[model samples]
Target: MISPTTIDQVFETARVEEVIGDFVQLKKAGSNFKGLSPFSDERSPSFMVSPVKQIWKDFSSGKGGNVVAFLMEHEHFTYPEAIKYLAKKYNIEVEETEQTNEQKEQQDERESLYLVSEFANSYFQKILHKTDQGKAIGLSYFKERGFTEDTIKKFDLGYSLDEWQAFTDEALKQGYKLEFLEKTGLTIVKEDKRFDRFKGRVMFPIKSMSGRVLGFGGRILINDKKAAKYVNSPESDIYHKSKVLYGIYHAKQSIAKEDNCYLVEGYTDVIQFHQTGIKNVVSSSGTALTPEQIRLINRLTKNITVLFDGDAAGMRASLRGIDLILEQGMNVKVCTFPEGEDPDSFAKQNTLEELSVYLIENAKDFIQFKASVLYEESKNDPIKKAETIRDIVNSISKIPDRIKKEIYIQECSKIMDISEEVLFSTLAQINKKDFKEADKQYKTEQRAFEVIKQQPVKKVDVQYVLERKIIEVLLLYGNRTEGFEDLILKENDKGQLILEPVINRAKVFEKIFLDLQDDEMEFTNPKFKTLYYTIIDTLNQNPEFQLKNFINSVDTDMANEITTILMEDERYALDDWERMHIFPKEKTQNVAQLVTETILSLRCFLIDQKVKEVQQKTIENKNNVNKSVLEEVKDYSGLKMLLSRKLNRAL
Candidate 1:
């Protein structure tokens, strides 16, 4: 647990844009920064970060919150992990809330896996630097590959001892559970026996986007005929190889700054490129291309350059990955090294300038690369040439943008000596059957492009809306002292109960609290009700209260609700709201009227709800209806009518 003071300081110092900008590419949109939703794959920007309000909202995924919440949601971090991450980023010393031994033991499984992996990473580094065998074998292997000491330490390269039980015995002796160590795949425990999983191997720590070590990739130094050369941590709670990109933790900033990601196949390829002063490179970490991996890069940039070793046969097979990139609507360029040179060997052989110059001079667009390779393979055979054209056209069809597709098709026609009409026809045929499965799934359903056609619209919850408005007013202007027309239930000359306006000067929160107390009413929605209590209680205690403490102390999910209430106007224009045929009642310039109208609307809605409830029971009754129920409905209806009249609206 983190102490309250430190948590408050984190929320105060961590700017929402600065934090989210590390993950999502945000551009200025009015007072807010907007970008594509990292939670969803969309072409347009709907994710918004508000620096002024210090919150973010992914409208596509409905995930909205403050900075800490963003980390917890995006990176799947625990609350403490998120706080500590922010504390480290901003140089704030975290004041921790002490936990009992039992509380510490009760930590969740995923966090335990993370902790074990962290321990393994730190232990590996210790062995690589401290032990004679590690410095001689693992350090020697990395040094032989031309990696400098700084580069080796930056990537946290390390070596596990050659002995089978070396790491397992050490971990157990350190009080780590065998279950977690085994589950994290750092140790293999079976049949009352345990051993190191990465025995006698150089360590490659696989990390999440936020830099936490998730798993490890290990390489054996002495290649035995029967033994495998490389081994990676099996899929655990934290490590999903398909979704993890090696070096993304270090490459994210450079990728965003350069607006390009250099993708390679192996860990060495990524490291070699980074060593050459090209920092925006990541590897698929030996896995085949995946949409999930591409989307990770997509969050940072829309451009990728696939760098392949000089193996032409390998490049031909790897060309399939370019289609996946094209499907993601990315601008892709492909570059291969000179024959007999991989990224690792080529990078080690050349200076940074040489590697940089070679890439710029040789990089080709996806269409050109695909066409050149396939065309060369086609030779003088007519049938082979025709198949090559179709293959190139298929790649073009993968592009989602029509304009880009046409441009690629035109380029293909010029390269293949084919007509644009022929290429277009081929593309249309390829794309026509692309959605066949989706069409079958949605045959009876409404088309997605058409938002609502025959589907029924959900009825608005009147009371819920009113409750939100009440919360919104309190969040915006709760402490402001204003003259209010306090409606008092009084009897006129005829002795019948009627409402009269009694003038009073009071804080807005005090007025709303008193009225709700007088009516013995509470918010009908749980989310809104909890928020109302928090805001009212805080404002009542200190009339000069600022929103920083309130927003900071609230639960993360509640922060979304708070932003939804506080930043409603950021989403819509009040000036043009009437054009949509909905009149704006609350959030007016006059704070008193905004507060008064919201409370009145809520009262009217609650009264209406009560009358409906009474009427429902009256209809369900088989015996004579209770006289009290009928009077209750009539009296609530009369009060609703009076409140409606005061609001100058008809019920």
Candidate 2:
């Protein structure tokens, strides 16, 4: 129900790069910016952002759109949410039409879940700051862990009351359904009894990349023998713990600014580091690191440093994560704390500078860290040592950049006391094995898809010719006041002013556009009805609509289509062509240019003929020498002169 004026503001203010840059780290690549694909696992960057066009396109994923579309695709935001987010970011006032109950009922389940989760986040946060149970339990726990009031508020940390159904009572009173509460695992329903799921536990709300709260992780206060220490929201439409990392919402900016992400294993680890002035840190929250999570981090920064407790098991568990990070085309380094120390304890015990210095001095490359950790475990046994070396090399092979792979291989050989050639040989074998398997998988999927390659639309013949002529006229002279003669047509021996079958180029476009609204049509095909509509819309909007603007608005998928329609039937080098008759020099260029212009101009005239003929034929068939049809031809004749002027600009 957003107003058209507000929607226009959102579109105007939401710069595509500014919005998408929040989730993807963009680096300048020629005229465009390129980044790793957020939707896929790719080493080379295939995601492109065009600031001039106000759109982003991911070649790897085949998704492309303007700023709102990017938000819809990347963060999975609803159209209204995306518009509201842009408005907030750009500080624009939003005016919305009132929604009825039926309109509210039309919201999808996924949207409903997002709304419920967002409401819960606000509810929990209010309790933490306002209620006695929250202040006494959650605030105390965070304070005891060395978090300041500012840090606590920044993260929106909160708690659920000890009494069962406390949150449920408030939610239900607010008209939130118990079913959604149970579905989101906010209120556990057992034996037909519903109660607040996180009763008495401090809250940790997990947020999506765009900062909407998707779920929660809560910790209990008492050391109850029967109760689990921590509980997280169950998997739902909006929340997937395995695919999300804690503190990402807060740390994404810092990570991008610093160009490195500090990866930890607990919520406390994130708080302690941020409290100590290191803001580019996030936690796995004790879940095993996943490629999806790593790719999420990869989208923000290419460098990741894993921080682990000094325990042997913790360090070993971190090794697997390191390999996955490498597989994601990221430069990874590992930093383990002093024995018995973790990020939380270590940061609390030391100054920010001291902690940072320790991390920097102790950080080791993935291969060195792996070799050092496993070398002792293997205990100089030849087979065990060889297996360890191969394992490290296999991880190295995962790196997509050849130069980086070579450097790591060289470093690994030096650290493991093995020959460089041996590691290189091992890496090649592993890479070949992986490549073959991937190729086979891709071919299998492609074969399945090949079963139904969609058929192409039939080429537009006369209608296309006519439409392009009108579009060209509208593009160049829609608002211009040019003198016109009122041509008359004789109908039943009576003479009257003529109007074309579809006169007023803008009106003609709108009528034809409304007539063709198929969703399955590919806009790339020049014959596509959708393509004609798209072009017509652009032509009708701007009084000064030019060919360049039309070309700029389209994505690569439609770029050729627009370009072909504009240039193939429109002259660009008429002046140069004229030069050929007068000049001794520039024969090749002038002749070629003349040939091109002749072809283009003839095409335009032919299209105009088709438009006139179609209008004339329709009038003749009706046996009414239509007066409107004569006026249409007169208006079109005036447009033809303007179009010729546009084409002969150089003259």
lDDT of each: 0.86, 0.75
As a whole number from 0 to 100, the lDDT of residue 76 in candidate 2 is 87
Clashing pairs in 1: none
After superposing candidate 1 on the true structure, give the runs of residues whose Cα lies further than 4 Å from its correct spot. Answer: 1-3, 95-104, 444-458, 481-506, 515-521, 556-590, 607-646
Number of the top-ranking candidate, with lDDT as the measure: 1
Clashes of each: 0, 9
lDDT value, residue 553 of candidate 1:
75
lDDT of 2 by residue, 450-477 (tens): 7755656577565455555444443333
